[model samples]
Target: MSQSIHTETSLPIEREVQAAIQGQRALAAYLATRFETQRIQIFDERNEAHQIELPTSALRLLVDILAELADGNAVRVVPVHAELTTQEAADLLNVSRPHLVKLLEAGELPFHRTGKHRRVRFADLMHYKGERDRSSEQALAELARQAQELGMGYE
Candidate 1:
């Protein structure tokens, strides 16, 4: 069975969200420019201290995630081996449940049956998404080329 991925955050006002997004962007930029590994120290209210080290790549990913969250975006972190439900996969692809089912039925995307439900591997879904994006980009480029050739005022 596939597990649900929940990413819910509440920030009612737009101004607060904008401020958070700006702060995240600035922190991300600073982290990107910094060369040294980051060590984080946490102190509890009771004065207990804890320290942890973060690799640069992991820090970069954290920064990106933070920026997305700050921008009021719901982010879900799934392991590469995680299996997602049909609804979750559809949501990730920004398509309807029926459409995603159609793709699965057509073998356009791979999925496994969990009883009556379909479960898609996170890695497989990501691969499909990347391929779809690249295909769209290529098709758009081709259309632009054709438009340019026809003097349709397209750059």
Candidate 2:
């Protein structure tokens, strides 16, 4: 029997949605009612929009539709954290200081101050690691399939 492959795909968020998420409150609720995609769009009063893509059974075309309406605005999801040092977060992610800071500001990983220093939570680090691992596994699987098709399996 042929092996069954399950692939996960995500659509790119528009640029306008990200702005709306930052500027308007009413727009968020309005879009929530109008759109039924697995993901939700964040927006602010300034018409800025951003998107948070959720893995759901929504139609594959929803991403394109949203992009057309969003006008390019899309929100990036940041993880909420409790308390952990910047160095600690970086160590867990195996990245440099500058990159970690960029992630924090880009809304990829959220952090806060406990006394006078920045901190991230253990949970967030692990979650990010898991995401990375999943991607790695997917790539490896694809590579293996290609190798087998070429009449070459592992040595």
Task: Identify the candidate with maximal TM-score.
Answer: 1
Candidate 1 residues lying further than 4 Å off, grouped into runs, are 1-37, 47-49
lDDT of 2: 0.62
lDDT of 1 by residue, 51-113 (tens): 977776777776776677677775667789989999989999999999999999999999999
Could you say which candidate leads in lDDT? Answer: 1
Residue-by-residue lDDT tens digits, candidate 2, 1-155: 54435333344355556643343443333344444445567798998998877544333334444444455533232334335688867866889978998888887876777787777787877787788889999999999888888879653
Instruction: Compute the lDDT of residue 149 as modeled in candidate 2.
Output: 83
